[model samples]
Target: LHGCSAVTYKLSKDNTTCLIVETTATASVSYTNSNRQKLVATWPLGEAAAISGQCESETKGQASLNLTFADYWVHMSFASSGGKASLAGIELFVTVQNGSRFLSPNSTGGLLLTASPKLPLSADTEHFACASELRLPFGQPGGSALVLSATKIQAFGVRNGSLSAKFATCALDARSSVPSDSTTAPSNTTAAPSDTTTAPSDTTAAPSNTTAAPSDTTAAPSDTTAAPSDSTTASTDTAAPTNGTSTAAPPTSAVPTTASPEPPLLNVTVFNSARVPCLRLQLRASLSILYRLKSGGNATVKVALPADTKASGDCGNSSQTVQLSFMQGWRSDLIFVKKASGYALQHLAADYRLSPALFPNAAEPNANRSAFGNGTYFSVASGTAYYSCRSAETLRLDNFVTMETRDLRAQAFRTDNSSAEFAGSMEQCLDDTPIDNVVPIVVGAALAGLVIIVLIAYLIGRRRHSAGSGYQSV
Candidate 1:
């Protein structure tokens, strides 16, 4: 209702068939395609404008008008003829249901629910919302989106190592909320999201007191550095000198300071491995030692590579070294890049990514289909990680990704008695743990040893028989 100059609502990433705009002010409306290019002025035309009726109501919820925009990102920009637009309340309804719901970002940073076939739909169906360009403004808390009663499904943004407007959901609805956006809008649209979001790895190995902080806001935040290192000590910023003059701070000897021991380096080691090139790294975290990095938050993660083998993939895109932050929808590219000489890119390619099996099959009923439900859930699924290979003897990756909630919370539906709660770090680590090789190596070795012993006995018997005359004479 309170906006700078116009009120715009982007309907969905998919093409929209119908749209109903409800507002309390007289303003011009426009539309845009999937690419955000404005279409012809459809709302206020010479003949249509007169018939559309001028909304002169000052009361809230007084005007309800419907328009048809058959495109994606149906940007309905409302501008008043008086050079300023004042809307008491606005509701946008779209008829573009790709079996997914749309939770658009409102001007107030809360999510505004938009639907195609309308709300209060069944829970058995797949319903995920897609916000192609949904993003939070800079410096906004990761917990910006608010969960309203209208939001039937659990929604969390997926960063995918990039802050893209994508979310993943598992399970379906229990309670139902009546749709307030439109009268025709159905109720009970609570469903799971369609897309699959992999969880970020947990910060295994208690974060060291001297963990590095992220200088880049986009990158993961720095691990909590408790005790200052010998080389660098945590110091407060000093005031600038007057008249553009600079003054050097007193030496350490001049000021009394506590001697803080340095924190240890995170020991990132592999937990398990097989004869094959796959290995698993357990992501651990210490909840007590919390570090707050300016740009991205910090988690201590360590990785140990095989002797003479270096990692090469999107996980190590910036360098062989990568930093991970735990912001909502924040993802660190985790698939390992296979060295050309080490592993075949094709071998490491994933068939199809899947949600983590930490939950029951009914919890995430369909492996191929994604849905929304209530509860705070974490997914430990396998999918195309950062690694790419062609064939064997090439780099092999244990396909694993971690999914967690930003709030580390699960809310119960008001209408349903159902709720989901998983124990462990919302910052779960889904590393590919190598399964033990099922080749009968130990059994084969025992058989081979038996065969050798029998052969040796037979040879000795034959030799003794050839020399039997000497023993018989004795």
Candidate 2:
């Protein structure tokens, strides 16, 4: 054993047969993936009367053990029960056929125990039931080893890598029925039927059989006849245990540890904040939008302005997509134009030099004229409601320009479902100041100039009269 109670081996490939020379000591065999450091399979032997036990190796010869796998692994380990457990030796091979050296422990040059010790038989007498720890090997190999009688051979099947059907009878009893006295142990005793009913009958006869000294006598028709009956019952009754076994199977539904990825969403809203008549009125227009994404990536976004609206600072090209890290948003001032029934926004140009972002800082007045490049360009995604034209002193209407996200990818454009109707009049753009106000201001200025001219003439006449009168007095 490599460790305190286990033997670990490294194999080149899969589908290996582990030929172990073990006594009736209970043990557990397991497989592991060294690369992944993961436990692959574990078979707790001798825990249950059923799939646990070692064959009678003293006189009959070393027992042959075979296990199969689907995928190749690099490491495997075998652990034995702490009780008088002895591993004579073990051999790794691909396949086993009749007369093969693997069939006998003494036949080939391999890892082997220097001395073959006859293990003392187990005195424990337990009902032979399927091992609770029995598990099929990985890859579900359907191979089996037969329990042979000195007179004949009985076939047993390995189903889903676990010993099933008649084989379970002998295999399950391998541990509990170890002969207490090995030198006088009967060779034929291995063929005893493994069943709840036959277990008691053998115990009652164990004392008498020990006194009789005829090893072949105990292996007589009693066990052979009962073996077939038990096999038949095993074939029919196995379903019950299979159903119970399923209860112990791995859980089918497990919650995932990591969260699923979420895609980006686009939103757009328009407010008719500024409205003017069709008489070429200048309306204050502002574009403010927020963009958000779950992941960090470059995106191409574009926001279309009203046809006549003028844009300079942040709003980029009407149709061209601005490529940027645009995680948050962009904001800018726009010139809204009042036309016939609706309003228009001029196209905003993009600056290729700067990075794009959501909620960009407002540009400083005349900042673009400096030697530095035009500030970063950001474009809103499209889709807007109705445009309006109305006369107003201030362009600050609550809901004139609105936008939302639309394209889920490169652009955060508003969905088409968002819409609004123009609430303003259909008149053309006009000056907001009234004509009456202008006429009054012009008339008042003319009257004041005429009065000043009259006052100057009066002063000149008075000065001449004073001069004539003063000449006589001087």
Candidate 3:
């Protein structure tokens, strides 16, 4: 094991390993296996670690794994290549009987078997795991977790996005053996992120060669330009950059839409919405009610004003934008914001003084009451709100806010063969591509022609006609 230390188990940069004896001086080390499996030699091998060679006389059917020195413990890990590889004459294999497995040593933790294999769990998720905070380290490829903390149904780091972690909990160690070269960006976890992320109208048109397949992705607005005439108005214009993938974007300015006849008492706050670790933009402002767009815009939002009142705006992305209209007398949480496309928004529900997000009725289809509990495997449900508004309370809506609907996904459990499905998570715009109503647009356009013909004919006929003037006037 000492010679193997320099290259293997060093864990400096490359984490490669093979099944090795804990000590180099240890007698011929051998083990039985049913398949060709990759073995890993780990640093800080747990307590006593030793392995006996199957070829050795006294240790024919026995193998031990202990550290190189006395009082040192090392971890043992080996993948089975088909042949049964036994540890201390016992088979060390992974199998799922009732959705889980057994913990080794059988000390403080125990294994959990599904309640009844005859009636297996559904795929769309019908319940929550009964465990909590179960620590699971990464195992080798295709290896599953040994049921630890059977009472609390927690799978190490993976989250089940739904309210319950039943079908949502994932197998242990899903990361690839070779990590990606790309730098990992840590997700935002601030308690209250601000709402300053809207950008002004896109002035730049699509760059040349945006049509063909290209590396830089972005497109331009098909028809329209930045109206230098209207300095107060901001449009959410999509310009061609290259294709649909340019990293450089216009500066964040308020994208104004046609204003409605609403007062300024409304709040436009973004809710943090979900608890899963996601790559979402976080907002700090606590505006009021939020709505989702059913169609149109490429994350381009246009909030129009009624009287051209000079209302201040702010953006909450990468940097904080303070409100020019910040009034200390009024609570800052009273701004209305709608869910627009292209961007994401996040805020705490309490910031807006909103209602407690009502959890789905556990009695309903495929619901689990145990999901919101405090143990492992627990989670907030599909639409459950960590905070809720008081009954008979109303939150005023102020203006449009930015948000992305791409990440929302959902699935239903089939009562039949049992398979988990991928249903997108859009409370609105499930399939709202506007083109869904092609029949209406065509019908409306056809009816619109009669009015145009009548107006043109009336104006032409009313004009004075020159009778016989061409023949005599010359």
Candidate 4:
């Protein structure tokens, strides 16, 4: 929790525990590299463009690993299977704009342990799911070490997928916004679920069991403004009302009332913060997107959230970000940045940067309620798609396809089962830019055509001129 990002492993005992970024947002917090050990920040002339690597060391009964994130943070999880223990995966990805660069020195090969490794957890857990969050800096290099006579653990996995994060941040000034009277509240305090991966039973686990009491979604985004005199926000979650309605009105800003006019610029890109690597995020305006076409092994992915944002309808300004804790599966609060748009949010309380959004209940989906609340909706578009990634033009190695090709879509009428559609959709979606350096290519193609036409015209003109001169001389 303080320094390292990988799970702890005790070599003395034959026990192993891996950290898995299981897509759960609450409770995962990693410390920063107060002493920049993972990267060389200072630069001379051209000693090196950028530097990065992984370090893992095994001690007597345990192993020590150090990871560092430069700017943005990362997410990870831990899980155990067989006689081995894995620290789970903490993945990091960066998307550079046209002139920008990400992972300038993107390298993945890591130092391995000399001791006998542990076994991986196969799909025989009896449906036991380990959901946790591990937050680390974005530029932190991932490190793992195995001990002798120690159980083996798999590195947290990362794959390509179709998703991007929308960040909303708000401050819960106090808990007195909502009244306890039951009649004025909606029959359901929580948002109604839509058609998604699993049709959660009608008796969905109450959201209150997962986080603090819900905040008024109708309040302004900046309601988290001045700290209240009794600013004691409930640390634990209170049982939510049966569909209680939030009377709070939302404002456009997320900062305090006395704050300046500049809004909090949101960075919506492909973010991988977990035990397993996820696909690269493609940020298009306020919306970020990814798509996975297939999966060979198990590609269980969830961009574990640290916190969330909120904007109450009653708030004078509508554009606001209220931070809330992110909850996995069917248990979590869902808030819409705006009801007219489909972008939504799920709070990840574990994330240090987004701790403000501990609980927000009144917010609902903007336009696409089918997307439901804030959690990233996981589904299969064409096949059992595993995640792949591409930040702009560059592709991620974790996303490279090693299996046979199938599900290739040539034409709607073309029957091509031999090709993998997943490889094309989710897997290949990240770096499938058919046109690279389009400007030059287009110009080159046009220039080549122009040259050919000009050459032909010159030849034809010479022949005609020669004929005319001969006729005049005759």
Candidate 5:
């Protein structure tokens, strides 16, 4: 065993549990150079020292161990159930101190590994082994790879307030030599047919009876002569033929009418003032709006935009626009603006007509909605590639209505630029609203008012006492 570590926890006053892990792991990063050449660098876990570690409980009553290294960190979580302790989650973080080594001058480092493979501790042998390699995606092929091999894991249970270190060796080293049952099953079935010799004798008697029946049927010419007249009579029956044709026609027509082609995806790319590509986005456009019905109830309706949306504006310009015109007299427009350091989404406006069936009791179903923002700026020179919003994010157009969007992807930088690769943590764009700070502002105002009242009362009482003393002396 190599690169081993152990962690012990005191569950109670007298009971304790321990976990031991032994494995060899390495991290390698690959990137492109300025001259368009690919290179890789590797660092082993054994070279780094474990500086600090702590054990904590998770939300689901599980134990987790967090270890910090000089250049990296490891988090391992475990779940105890059914008289066993199993690994629930594992994550590794690698810090790239010198970003220039990977052609990323603006990168601040990134996460290297994230996975959750439930592996239970062996009950009899007291060891678990892993036989696979983990890979991380870096927006390019062959980004980074992690190989964990010859791993041995053991967990000790609490027994009468003490710990036991007894464990057995894992048999993973000799697993390749053992033959599997699937490969041997076919050979055994094929060899068993050689022992059955009575199969040919039973087949010889069956052929003799079949040959005599065909010779006797050849002599019956009377039945063959009458077969054409019977078929002619059946063909003359128009009622049966008409019903069969009518029933089959509807099904063929219905199948083709229900199948509509999926809408094409829209791609929008933006450039900087220097004519350098900075941002790219692709999505199947859709609009969601909040409206009120005649019954005083509010609901949200989603309308898919047309695929043939007209796009206008030049790269590196101040703003770009995409206009979607529907056949039902509806229209939508999306606008993106160029900023000093980066780019941002400026506005989304739409005018839509709702179906009469959806709002039967409503007086008017025609509505218009829009959301505007100051726009969050993201830079490509900072080693950030992709920005994703996978869940529905609400953007309040006003106090009474909002808009939502989902499954949006935005990428930055040119194809050959390695400095724009994804690293560190993910970037998000949130609506910066003043309503989120109302609680803190109200509390501060209340405290300030109380301080002013106390000061004014103290000064008034001191002034009255000084005036009365001067009069009594006179």
Candidate 6:
């Protein structure tokens, strides 16, 4: 009952059978060398020291147990639904310090793991384990991998008077071998069958050509008898043959000239507080998602939003909601609120449908799921500007899934204007200065004021003491 306070449930009648609910967990991490062929070192979480652990239960049949290590944190979510209890999702947040053991020295960003199993789990199982491969946003091939294993697991909540004893373990290994050229073999096998089928068709056509040759020989003697009359008509037909050859040349050139030009990447209109058109945004970007493979590997899934993806929302209002509806059940909503500084994105919610064809080995459920994440301040502004087109930038939603975009050329202008024109550059969306940076300057100013107050008191006391000593004989 350590973490089951929020939920209300009755215990089972059997008292002798103790249901183990919770236990201590351990975490380990391994990193690969420069070659990415094998692991260079393996280290325990928190350097083999004790870590803090806690559990939280929710009323909606959801519970989470979190383990906070020194450099990284592990959070596991469990859900009891439809008379079944299973692990819903897992998230790992690793901090890459200057000399962090969990990551490489040159690694600029930390590792993040957010994944779920393909199927649900039942409480009757003795041992349960799941593994997923995580590719670093900045890493070589054969990236990192994480495995979660649990033993003696029973129910998520208290069944009777006793809690279940569940022991969980997390192991992260880097630079596992990845299969790169496995798909080419099947393509070659398919091509071989097509070539064999065409060979039989060519042989059948050869017999028809031989039969036509005998008919041509029978007609040759008839043509010699008519040669005197044919010569008289050949002088007039010479001009007709030249006209036929010139007409055939025009159709061949006309076929290729009808191709249309390429369309823009993204162009949409946004609204204002009054639900009137305020901003027209246009951008070109390449987007992709990092998904876990069923074979315990990681792969990239590219998504191309059409040029006419529908967008609807208000810009500078507290209840502003901008929605972008893409193809294939993919949608994104950006909620904004008005502040003293300006309008800023408060939350971002995205819904994506997984296709089994593209991700045949994906561990996630092939259904439409929504993930929400808090947006950074100063990430939205008015007017038009060219955002820097650099490397891919990743946006992680609450599900821990990352959406990456590269070669961004985003801009927004008033809809009343005829052309999209603005000289300002927009480099502040993801690169804005955070409010945390002001804390140090504020603390320094407070310390400086305290020192000035103490110095004034000391000087006033010294002056009073000297004046009293000079008149002190009284």
TM-score, one value per model: 0.19, 0.16, 0.16, 0.19, 0.31, 0.33
Tens digits of lDDT, candidate 5, 1-474: 134432232322101234455556665655444464656656666633332111222123344444445445555556656545555655454443445334432222232344454544444223343332223222232545444554445444434443333332222322335322223233432211111111111112111100000000000001111111101000111111110112111111111012122334555544433434444565554444333445443344344444444432222233433434554545544444444544455444444455553323332454322222222333322334455565555443211223445555555333333344232345554432125778899999999999999999999999899888856653
- TM for candidate 6 is 0.33
* Global lDDT scores for all candidate models: 0.21, 0.21, 0.20, 0.21, 0.38, 0.37
Q: At residue 254, what lDDT does model 4 achieve?
A: 30
Residue-level error in angstroms, candidate 5, position 125: 10
Cα RMSD for candidates in order:
26.3, 38.1, 28.4, 26.1, 35.9, 33.4
Off by over 4 Å in 2: 1-286, 290-438, 472-474
Which is the winner by TM-score between candidate 3 and candidate 6? 6
Per-residue lDDT tens digits for candidate 2, residues 19-110, read 22222222211122224232222122221110111122211322222222211001111222322122222211111111322222211110
Give the per-residue lDDT digits (tens) of candidate 1, residues 192-241. Answer: 33223111111111111110111111112222333322211122222211
Candidate topping lDDT: 5
Q: Report the C-alpha lDDT of model 6 over 146-213, residue by residue, as the tens digit.
A: 32222223445453444322212112211124222223233322111111111111112111000000
- State how far residue 214 of model 6 sits from its true place (Å): 84
Best by TM-score: 6
Model 5 pairs in collision: 110-424
lDDT of 6 at 77: 54
TM-score of model 2 relative to the true fold? 0.16
| Model 1 CA deviation exceeding 4 Å by range | 1-422, 425-431, 437-441, 468-474
How displaced is residue 258 in candidate 1, in Å? 39
Ranking by TM-score: 6, 5, 1, 4, 2, 3
Total clashes for model 6: 8
